[model samples]
Target chain A: MTDSKDTGEAGEVKKDHGVLYIGMDFGTSRTSVSASNGVRETVYSTVGYPKDIVSMKLLKKDVLFGKDAIERRLSLKLYRPLEKGVIKMGDDADAESKANLKAARDLIGEAIRIAKPRADELVYCVIGAPAKASIHNREAIIEAAREHVDSVMLCSEPFAVAYGLDWLEDVLVVDIGAGTTDLCRMHGTMPEETDQLMFDTAGDAVDAELAKQIQDTCPGAQFTVQMIKDIKERYGFVGEAAERVVVDLPVDGKPTPFDLTDQLKTACTVLIEPILEGLRRLIATFDPEFQAKLKGRVLLAGGGSMVKGLDTAVEKAMNERLGGGKVIRIEEPVYGGSNGALKIAHDMPEDFWEQLK
Target chain B: MAGFKETLKDAVRQMSFRTSLDKLKKKGVQNVNVLGVDRIIALIEAAVHRSLKSRMVGIDRDAVAESTKAEFLRLLRSNEDLQREKSQIEQARERAEEEIDLMRRELGEKRSLLRVKLEQDAMELVTRYSGENQAIAMKVAEICRSFAESGDASVSSVEERLMELVMDVVSGEREEAEVARKALQDREVGNLQRRIKKLNDTLVTTEQRLQQASTMKQFDRGISSIYREVQGLDGSDSHAGKKRELMVDLFKANLKLQKRGKGA
Candidate 1:
C-alpha cells in the first residue's frame, strides 16, 4: 500500500494513506457518529451479551446493540454502560462495573464499525463528552475510543453543540440528554471550568416522574419503566399541550385507555427549572456587556430538546426569571453534538493527531 | 539445519504405519522390511560419502560433502514449510465449512421467522374480513326488514333485490379486492424471494473466496484511505485560527489525562 508514496527532502519514504474523520456524541442513552465519508448512524447505548449456552446458540451472536439488544433483552445480559452522562466506572469497581466498562468499550468499537471506515484509512475522531465528566470518566472514554481510532479528542458536549452552528461567542448552549442536562457558555475561546453546569434532570428524570404520575393517577394500569419512557418520548410536552396525551396500558391482560396529559406535562416540566437556573448562573456570571448577547442566543439542543414546546417553555421561564431570553432549538437536536465534534475533528491540525496517536 | 535429523526421522516415521496381517496380504504386500533410525542415518551418510569419493577425485571431498548436506537441508526445510502451509490450508477450509453451516442455519431461522410472520398476517386479515362481512350482512338484513315494515315492497321482493345487489355489487368489489390482495402478496413474496436469492449469491461468493484463500492466502490487504496525514483546519475557513487554538487546548488536556492514567 505504501509502495507508490513520494519521498521527502530527507529521502525518507512518506506513506500516503487516506484519512477518515469521525465525530462521536457518546451520550447516556444514545451513541451517535458522523464520519467524513458521509456515514451517519445513531445507536442506543444499550449492549447485550448472550446469557448462557442455550441463549448463545439461539441468538447465534456473541453480542448485540441498539434495537436488536432491546428486543432480545430477555435472552441477554444487558448493560447500559453510560449513566448520568459519564461511563459508570469507578476505582474500586465491582464485577458488574467491570462488565459495564467492557460493554462501553465494545459500544465505542461498534460505533466506529458502523461508520464503515476504510481499513487503510486513518480514523481521526473527536468525541463530545459530558461537560463535567470526572478525570476518571474522561480517561475511560479516551481509552475506549482509542481502541478503534488512530487519534481521538474529547470536547464538552454543550460546547460542541454551540460550535456546530458557529455560535462560538456570546451563546449559551443547553444540551438536554437522557441522563443529564449540560449547559455551557461559549465566549469565542474554549469554555472554561466555570462556564459549564450539569444537572441530572433530563429525559430519564421525566420518564421516572411520568411513571410515578401514571401510578398515582391511573390505577389498575400496568406498565413498566420502558413503556413509560416510550409514552414520554411519544407524547411528552410542557406548557399548554396542543392535544391530549392519551395512552393505553394493560389492565387485567386487556388494553385500557388512560389520559396522561397532565402527567406528561408535569413530568416534562422538571427540565425547565434546572435549565433556567443553569442559564441564570451562566448569564449572570458573564461579562455584563455580553450577558445580553449570551441570553439572546440560547441554543437548545440534544434529544430531550425534541419535547414539543420545550424551547418556548424555556423562553417563557427565562422571561419570568432572567428578565428575558430567547431559546433557539437546533433543527437536528440529536445530531448536533456529533456534527460539531466532526467539525472539531476536521479542524484539528495533523500534528495534534500524530502526538495523540 | 539443526532440525535435519528430526525432519529425516519424521519423514521415515510418517511413511511407516501399522496394518493387520490380513489387510497387508489383501493388499498383496505380505512381506515387510524394518529399518531403525540410526541404521538409516548411517546408510545415508555412507552412500553420500561413497558417491562423493567416486564422483570428484580432484575436488575437496570435505567441501563437496558439506555443500551437498547444506543443499539437502535447504530442501528439507522447504518441505517442512510446505507441510506447515498445508496444515494451515486445511484449518482454513474447516473454518469455511463451519461458516457455511452457520449461514445455512441462519437462513433456516430467517425462513421460519418469515413463515410465522406471514401466517400471523393471514390470520389477522381473516379475522378482520370476517367481522366486516358479518357487519355488512346485518346491515343488509336490517334494510330489508325496514323495507318490509314500510309496505313499500313485498318481503320476497326485498329479499330478491338484496340478493341481486349482493351478487352484482358486493361480490364484484370483493373480487377486485381479492385480486389486489393477491397482487400485494405476490409483491411481498417476490421481495422475500429476492432476499433469499441474495443470500444464496453471498453464500456462493463466500465459498469461492474460501477456495481462493486455500489456494493462495496472500490477498488480505485492506482498503485504502483518502489522505496520508491528518487534515488540519482549511485555510479559507474564517474560524480556522480560533478553532485550531481550541483544538490544541483540547489535545493538551487529553494528553495530560492520558498521561495521568498511564502513570496510575
Candidate 2:
C-alpha cells in the first residue's frame, strides 16, 4: 500500500535522515525508545485509559501513551506489556494478553512515528527484549514491527548494555531491571543461550519487600507497587550503620516520622545474594584463560545499578569468594540499551541478516 | 368433657320428646301443623300425630320410633362425610388456582432466563459475527470506494448499489451475529484467539529452531530425512489456523450488538 503523502510539511523534520540510528531499549519495568535523532531520554513503558469511550472520543484519542498514559491512569486502563520482561499470554482467556501486546506495539509505534524520518531514510532498529524472553515473545515483538519500519532486530537487554560499553571481553554484565535481574557472560563474541542467565527478582522484588515492611510497621499507610517503587528509588541503599533515619508514615491517617533505616537496609540487601551467585557462576564459567580477567571486570548495568552501596556489597561478597576482583558500575542508565542497539545496527552489516541461524 | 356435654344435650332432647308425647295423649290433637296456637298445643300435636299415628297405622310404636330414629340418626352419623365433600370441592378450587399460579411463574422465569442467556449470547456473537460483518462491510465499502474513484458507473447507481449492499449485509450480519451471540452467551465456544496469537508469536523462533534441530543429524542422514524435515515445518502456519478458529469462537462469546433496541 502506497500513498502520495506530501513531505516537506511543518510536522516533518527537514534533516538528512541518513546516519539516523534508532535504538529501542524496550524493557519490562521502563522502556526508553531513543534515537540518535537528536536527544536521549527514558520514558516509562506504560499506557493509560480514559474514563470511558465518551471521554476518549471527547479527547479525540482512544488511549494515552507513555508518561501521559500514567499521569491519566485514574481515567484509563493502565497497561504494562513487558511484565516480567516478556508478554504473557492470558491463560485460557487472551483478551488481556492481546491487549498487552497491542498496547506495547502502539507505544513503540508511536515513538518511531514521532522520530519522523525522511522518505529515503534507512530506518534501522535494535529493539531490546528480556534476556530469557521465550521464543514466542521475541516473535510477537518482531511481528508487531512488521508495519512499523524497515529493518528491525531483537537483542537481549543485558547484551545491549554490554554492547553499549563495548565490553566484549570476559565481562559479566548484570542488568538489574524492573521485572528480573539478568546476568550474561561476554566471552568476546555474541553470547549464546548458555552464556545468559535470567532470574525473576530485581527492583520489583525490593519494592515488594519494602511495601510489605511499610505495611507491617505502619498499619494504615496507603501504599501500592508504584508508590513503594518511588520510595525505593528515592531512599534505596545498602549498608550497615548510619545516622538516625526517620521517614514519614501514616499514623492514623497522618504522616509521622518512624525510623526505617533497618528496613531500608534490609530491603536493599535482599538482592545481594543473587548478584553474588550470578558473578560466581559467570566467573567459574570462564575457561582458565580469562578466569582471572573475568574476576575483576564485572559490569553492573540498568537503573537498579544506581542503588547506593550496591557496588560495595557486590565487591565485598566477591572478595569473600574469589579473594580479589574489580566491580565497575556503568554511569549512564538512560542510553545503555540504546547505545548497545545503535552499535549493533552499525557493526552488523546489512547483509549479515542472511547469516542468522 | 366436650363429649359429655354433647351426650347430655341428646338426653334432654329425648326427655322433651317423652313429655310432648304425654301432653298429646291428653289433648285431641293428631298432627303437629294442626295443633292450636299454643306452646303445649304444638308439642302435644307433634307427639300424637308423629309418634302414635306412625305406630298404630304402621307397626310397633317403639319399633317405629326406633326405626325412624335409627334412619334420622343414620343421616347425622357421618360428620366427616360432610366435611370430606366440602373439603373435596375446596381442594379442587385450590389445585386449579395453584396450577395457574405455577404456570404463570414458570413462564415468567423461563422468559427471564432466556432473555439473559440470549442477550449474553448476542453480545458474543456480535463481536465475531459483527466482526465478520464489519469485515465484509469494510470490503464492500472498499469496493464502493474503488468503484467511485474509478467512475465505473453513474452517481445514482453507485449510491443505490451501496445502499443495497448495506441492507443485505445488515440482514445477513444480523442472522449470523444472532447465532454467534447465542453461541457465546451459551458459552459454546471459548474465545481464545488473542491468547493463541501471543503464544504463537512469542514461541515462533524457538519452535523454528526445534524443527531445525530435529531435521539435522550427527551423521547427516540421506536426502529422505532432509525432505521430510523440510516438509514438516510445523510452526507459524499451523498455529495461524488454530488462532483464527479460536478468535472466531472468542468473538462469538463476547460479541455485543452495535445497532438497536432489542433483537436488532
Clash count for each candidate, listed in order shown:
6, 23
Worst 10 residues of 2 chain B by lDDT: B221-230
Give the TM-score, chain B only, in order for the candidates. Answer: 0.55, 0.32
Candidate 2 has an lDDT of 0.65
Q: C-alpha displacement of A342 in model 1, angstroms?
A: 0.6
Candidate 1 contains a number of clashing pairs equal to 6
| lDDT tens digits, residue span B1-264, model 2 | 334334334533433534475688679766666322244434643774586775587556765545444433433333334446556556555555555455555556555666676677568656766677667868787877888798888878778877877787789868866875675543322323343444455445445544544444222311111011111112354333432332233222212211111123
C-alpha root-mean-square deviation, candidate 1: 19.1
Clashing pairs in 1: A17-B227, A17-B228, A18-B225, A18-B226, A18-B227, A19-B227
Segments of candidate 1 deviating more than 4 angstroms: A1-16, B1-229
Q: What's the TM-score of each model vs. the native?
A: 0.65, 0.53
lDDT of 2 by residue, A250-277 (tens): 6577887777777777888888898888
DockQ of each: 0.23, 0.00
DockQ-based CAPRI category assigned to the predicted complex of candidate 1: acceptable
Candidate 1 chain A minimal-lDDT segment of 10 residues = A1-10
